[model samples]
Target chain A: MPNKGDFWEVNCYNNSLMYSHHTKQKSLACLALLFFHVLLQAQSPENDFLRSTGKIYSVVAGIVIVFAGLAIYLWRLDRKLTKLEKHINDEHETS
Target chain B: MEGFTDEPGVDLVKPEGIRFPYRSILNETIRNTFFHVALWMAMFSLYLVGLYHAILYLRTSRKDHDLWSEAYNKAGILFGIMGIATGSLWARYTWGSWWTNDIKLNMATIAMFIYFGYVILRSSFTDEEKKARVSAVFSIFAFVALIPLVFVIPRLTDSLHPGNGGNPALGGEDLDHTLRLFFYPSIIALFLIGCWLAQLKFRLLKLSDRVLKNR
Candidate 1:
């Protein structure tokens, strides 16, 4: 009787702890990348130099969009970190 | 009775502690993955780089370009070994075989061997300048041959390797969206890490050259 309850209790505890911290951080990064990817796709030119030529153009366009999004995200992240650093330095000076 | 009896005041000895950072993403095992993917990507990237150096060697007949060409060729071979080891482990899990004669697999093997011969050709020459020049020419030829062996040949034949003759490389039901989510990031991260390692290697080579000349 004790063993049965022990197994059930363990299962319940495991179910509650669904996502780990690492997985959460990875998910956030993925979401940021996907959001930028969608924005890029929407803003992409219809009569583009590569896309207008052939089927391979779509593949090329997709690659360009993904990389551009990645670049933009990295740039913004760098800027945010710089601002955070400056804020921290200002606080230190004030104290 | 003596063997079974415990000595008075005897204490169990514990092994030395090795602590790893809790937040660190890079571990000893994860480092292997970096080497694996980096070598493959570097092998591919350096092949292209060597191609450019080869062209320069052919057109200009400059020894510096030839030196760089030989360096890239050497780097490519080193990475190829890492790639094959990583791929063999990857295959064990995914393909249920350590080695397969799949079109892509065979093509990659041939491409690696072709570059291996490039190293052999360099060693065959005794004269420094002549060795570099001949090696550069061979590197260029190997680079050209790589295009067909690694890419075109695999694409022309049906095989289990991703993005070969039968199916699109990243497309298809095999690499579902779930896998792509992790796979794409892995590719980019691994490629960047590869470049970093190659730069380090090139710097070490330059330093070693200086040391050798001084001695």
Candidate 2:
């Protein structure tokens, strides 16, 4: 037979393991609750319809293109200004 | 309805699931995350650029550095205002009020006042060199003050805002994976736009300076 000390030690180890396992499962359940909340929010019919038709991407593409164009234009303007500043400094020095 | 994916890279996780996380009140308005959070991030970035120019002005006493600092500060303040406006709207939608007694909000207001004072302080000095020196020093001090006021204090105490007071509103289980794609881009876009605005303003300041010299 196992010694009394050995028995208690094994019992304690099992109890601690059980406790941790229980907590882990509880936390997992909480995560599921949280994701369920997100799922519910996304259940709107109109939003679903738009996504299903892939039409939402047209809007996304349009926005992306416009913003990209604007960024390019701004970058060119910045370069022009830098050149102008250099030209002005040259004129002033020559004068 | 069938889930569709015309774009290959876009999410097709579920027929009905939005790839973004959601809280009850923040449901659809979670889209505002791009605007509200990105504006503050952009503002902080622009302010850092401004502070760098401010330090450069102090070191070199260059007129262009002073003007650049002023332009960056103006753009930073503009984004700050946009941040506050978007935040207030988000607050009203979720927290049921446009303003609240939250520590973060109050501290942010104080930070704005400090920067605004920096502008007024600069304008008060008649001498150009004196204005640049004093304002540059003030900008450095204000930025230092902002760190503790806006960021540090909020984390150290209980807060109703997400990511504070043990709230699970921002990290781990809260921020959805797909949102990162849009969120990061929003920050980059806003920062670029703010810098663009600053550059434009800098050009105007330089042009006016040139005209004044010519006259």
TM-score of chain B of each: 0.68, 0.88
For residues B92-185, what per-residue lDDT tens digits would candidate 2 score against the true structure?
5457677999988898999999999987998799888889888999989988998888778876677766545543344464455567678899
Candidate 2 yields a Cα-based lDDT of 0.70
| The best candidate in terms of DockQ | 2
**Maximum-TM-score candidate:** 2
Which lDDT values do the candidates have, in the order given?
A: 0.55, 0.70
Give each prediction's DockQ, rounded to 2 decimals.
Answer: 0.01, 0.02
Model 2 stretches astray by more than 4 angstroms: A1-95, B1-18, B166-174
DockQ of 1: 0.01
Docking class of 1: incorrect
What's the CA error at residue B83 for candidate 1, in Å?
1.8
Q: State the weakest 10-residue window (summed lDDT) of model 1 chain B.
A: B1-10
lDDT of 1 by residue, A1-95 (tens): 12234434544544444554665766756654665554444325432222222222333333343344335534654665566557556757877
| TM-score for chain A in each prediction | 0.43, 0.41
Put down candidate 1 lDDT per residue, B1-215, tens digits, no spaces.
01111121112222355321111111112223333444566578867777788789878987667666766665566557657766665454345467988877788898888988987888798787788777777887888898888768777667754333553554474333433454566656645544544454455445445444554
Of candidate 2 chain A, the 10-residue stretch with the lowest lDDT total is A49-58
